[model samples]
Target: MPWQHKIAYLIGKPVGISLSNGQGTSGILCDVSNGKLLVLEYLYQSQFALKQYDFHMIQDINGFPPCMSQRLY
Candidate 1:
């Protein structure tokens, strides 16, 4: 399995996602399948519906409490 497949285990858990475009968001990993990702909601999104994004856009998974990562700058 690829790294993304392993990350699928995060389902139902909160994780920080850094996109290739340098944008970031945190949400519950609701689903990861068929080249798509379904998150419960981004950190700044107020609606409770799941949001979808292309799996390829995901650059990294910053784990829970994502702020633990060292600053890149």
Candidate 2:
């Protein structure tokens, strides 16, 4: 799927992201920049942090229900 379509569908939603490096994380999809970066707000060390991932490094993206996201915070 195209980035724009995926971005629009996932923005403001909780999602699980799998990266090419074999690492994964779940976070709220915050924004996209230059159509090549994804900004995700996630919990780290008991605090919420924003992280940016390169589009090409993402292997997959899955949406999680809002209820699941609530449990994180």
**What TM-score goes with each of the models?**
0.70, 0.69
Superposed model 1: Cα runs more than 4 Å off: 1-5, 42-46, 66-73
Q: What is the lDDT of residue 8 in candidate 2?
A: 75
Q: Rate residue 31 of model 1 by lDDT.
A: 82
Relative to the true structure, candidate 1 has a C-alpha RMSD (angstroms) of: 6.0
What does the lDDT come to for candidate 1? 0.77
TM-score of model 2 (CA atoms): 0.69
lDDT digits (tens) for residues 18-57 of candidate 2: 8889998888888777755455664657688788888888
Q: How well is each residue in 1-73 modelled by candidate 1, as lDDT tens digits?
A: 3447557578788888889899988888888778888888744556576888797898877458546667789
Q: Model-by-model lDDT, in order?
A: 0.77, 0.75
Clashes of each: 0, 0
Model 2, position 64, has a per-residue lDDT of 83
By TM-score, the best candidate is 1
